[model samples]
Target: MRTRAKLSLSLTVVAMVLGFMVTLQYRQTLLARVSDVTASYTDGRQKELADKVAQLERVNKDALKRLQNLNGEIAAYEKESAGADAQLTSIQQNLSRYRILAGTTPVEGPGISVTLMDGQYNGVGSVSDYTTHDWEVNYVINELFTAGAEAVSINNYRVVANSGIFCIGPVITVNNHRLVAPFQIQAIGDPAVLKGALEMQGGILDLLRNVEDIKVSAVKVEQNIQMPAFTAAVTAPPSEGAAQSTKSSEGKQG
Candidate 1:
């Protein structure tokens, strides 16, 4: 009986020890897993913060660069403005002198109204000898200048020496300016001379009618046309007035 009791006690003790060892091992494993998770979370958070800081730095750098560029641009614009104002003052004084010198800008009186429409003459195949709007305008302007026109305008767009005429599809531009036709050309000169140069009864009119069958109209009228004076750039100084003023000052001193 005694031996059996001791054997039962030893068995209980062995079971308890086995249970304790198992609990300790489980606790260590759980602690290791929790530690790994905490480290990973901390690492992820740190990386996120670092990336945000880097992005902010980049944005700040870009903003600073933009601000510097804008400041530089503002300084340049102010300098340019000052120079332009000085130039403008110098120009206004000179223009006053030119107006006096020209006595009067050219005025339109008793001029002919010449209309040159698009040419349409087909020779062979489907190809027609139709003149484009450009050709007609060019030919008319050239003919007008040859015909001694002081000034000319097409569709009220002034045809100056430095005028720009460009074509985009069916539309035509004058002075980088667009307009729709039929083109109205106003030439300020002797109507008789212009008419003679264009369609002198048996000149270009007869030739166009017989050769190409193109139509051109020239009619004489007593009328007035005036072209606006171009805005002058500030380079050429006032010649006569300044000289006169200087001479008058000299005379006064004498």
Candidate 2:
């Protein structure tokens, strides 16, 4: 009976030790599983944060590129605006110059003045031969233009591209206004060239001097010759037939 009790006590002690080992092993397995889950969660969180950072970086780079493009566009617009301003200023200056040349604006400069007078009627020839005609006035004006006269006036009347000189009876009309003897002509140009052109052999001045009934004189050079602006209403263009009739009338009058 003692042998049987000793064997039973030994079996009980062995069973208790086995139980303690099993519990320790189970706790260790549970702790390992928890650590693995925690590691996976931390890894996932880090990956998500990294992806968000990369996305923000891309967005920021795109925004910077767009901002740079906008700056370039603004600079180009400013440059274009500056060029347009310069062109506009140049155009305005040219317009002002053209207006002066068109006689729309009054002008003053150094120039020459010509005086023409009718000789005393000696009763030696026809009345027309002793008087100045519109053709003669037109000829003198044409010569002045050929000599590079920038501006011209007949008896204070501005002579523009469409100015006309005609005769009414014995009186000569310039710009549709009656102008009597001693017709004064003012021209703006190089004084030396103008004087030389008028005084040249067989020139307008010389031809007038040769005529027994016409007297010609020139100022040669005069400073500060002011020219008034053209003030007459523009005449409409004449039809072909009307132009022919007018030419025929002028010829007969001449």
Candidate 3:
């Protein structure tokens, strides 16, 4: 009976030891599983953060490219605007010069004036022979131009490229207006040069005094000579289509 009791106690101790070892092993396995899950979650979070940073970098790059394109467009527009302003200024300057040359604008400068009259009634020839003819008036005008006259007028009638000078039944007609002697011929130029040209030996003045037996006063240099714009009609009548268009516009306004 003592031997049997000793065997039973040994069996109990062995069973208890086996139970403690099993419990320890189960706890260790559970701890290992928890560590694996935590590691996986950390790896996923790191990957997500990296992907987000890459996406932001791409967005920033695209935005910078768009900004560069916008800057280039602005520079091009500024250059084009500057070119247009310069072109407009050049066109205005050319138009002003053209208007001056066309004699459509008034002018003022220093010049010379001369008076011409019929020869003194020395009863030697016909009355018409001693009279100042239209040709003689034209001759003086031609001489003034040859002397570098910029503008000229007779009795305040501005002489232009299309001006007409002829005789209308014993009366001299300049631009269709009657002009009698002592014809006042005014020219705009350098005062000294004009005087020199006309008063030169055997010049227009000398020829008129000797050959034509006409009275020509000394050239008078003026400090200021005002010339009016050509008042004669210049523009032609509008075409049929243009006239209709103008009429239509007027009707609309009415």
Candidate 4:
């Protein structure tokens, strides 16, 4: 029973990760297409880009279909195992924990939200200085996680283990999804603790306000905050060395 339960959980996690990775890849492809669509592109180039986008759309659709099938299969297995009350409950509890860790589950609870915006420009030395940087956003996220934030989001984009925050011109991309100021960061955790972490003296708020010159608003504690599951891939791309090692291992097995 233990072995079967572990196997089922492992398979489900693999399926969820693959689905997210496929979605993330599709989003990245779209971002690339957007970047490629410059005024300098010729008619032929535009047509080629359109073709690639269409192909990717089909791929994304197929991946979603597969994920749906996998979910159905898992559901059927759960139904079959429901007869074992004690074992089933234990399995379910473990599954729920893993789902949260994998970020495949949406979470809602009492938490806090912090809003950051660009400071007012007074013919400033550099506009960037008054704006929020990706690192600053990440700093807040890191702080939240350090303070026991179970889940976090920025402008409704779920921040998972593998989520990246980087600047693209005036915008920041999370999970390859672009967002602009003011960025509202919401986290699911203890309201007071999360709020205190951000509002503490010389904390994230102080650094953003005094050093970064960002418009840092008061952290609002809420009784209920909803954060969506990470829809993009949680797995980081394997390094070249790791890929080569896997290939060598496969060769040895063969």
Q: List, in order, the clash count of every candidate structure.
A: 1, 0, 0, 0
Candidate 3, residues 215-240, lDDT tens digits: the string is: 88989999998875554544434667
Tens-place lDDT per residue, model 4, 1-254, is 99999999999999999999999999988776776656335578787887898999799768756765775577577667765698887886577678777776567888999898878644334545423456788789889999999888888767864455552212235444355678888988989999998999988789889998888888999899887667666665567798788877896784
lDDT of all the models against the reference? 0.58, 0.69, 0.71, 0.75
The residue-by-residue lDDT of candidate 2 on 113-206, one tens digit each, is 8888766644345545433544566677788888998888877767764544552212234444455666788888898887777778878887
Q: What TM-score, to 2 decimals, does candidate 2 have?
A: 0.51
Which candidate ranks first by lDDT, i.e. highest?
Answer: 4
In candidate 2, the residue pairs with backbone N, CA or C atoms under 3 Å apart (3 or more residues apart, or in different chains) clash, namely none
Candidate 3 steric clashes: 0
lDDT of 1: 0.58
Candidate 3 residue runs with Cα over 4 Å from true position: 1-97, 121-132, 166-177, 235-254
Q: Rank the candidates by TM-score, best first.
A: 4, 2, 3, 1
Question: How do the residues 89-186 of candidate 1 rate in per-residue lDDT, one tens digit apiece?
Answer: 57655554454233222234556666555455332323122234455566667777788876676654445533334321112334333443455667
Residue 191 C-alpha lDDT in model 4: 90
Q: Which candidate has the top score in TM-score?
A: 4
Error of 1 at 229 (Å): 5.1
lDDT of 2 at 198: 79
Supply the TM-score for candidate 1: 0.38
- RMSD of candidate 2 to the truth, in angstroms, is 43.9
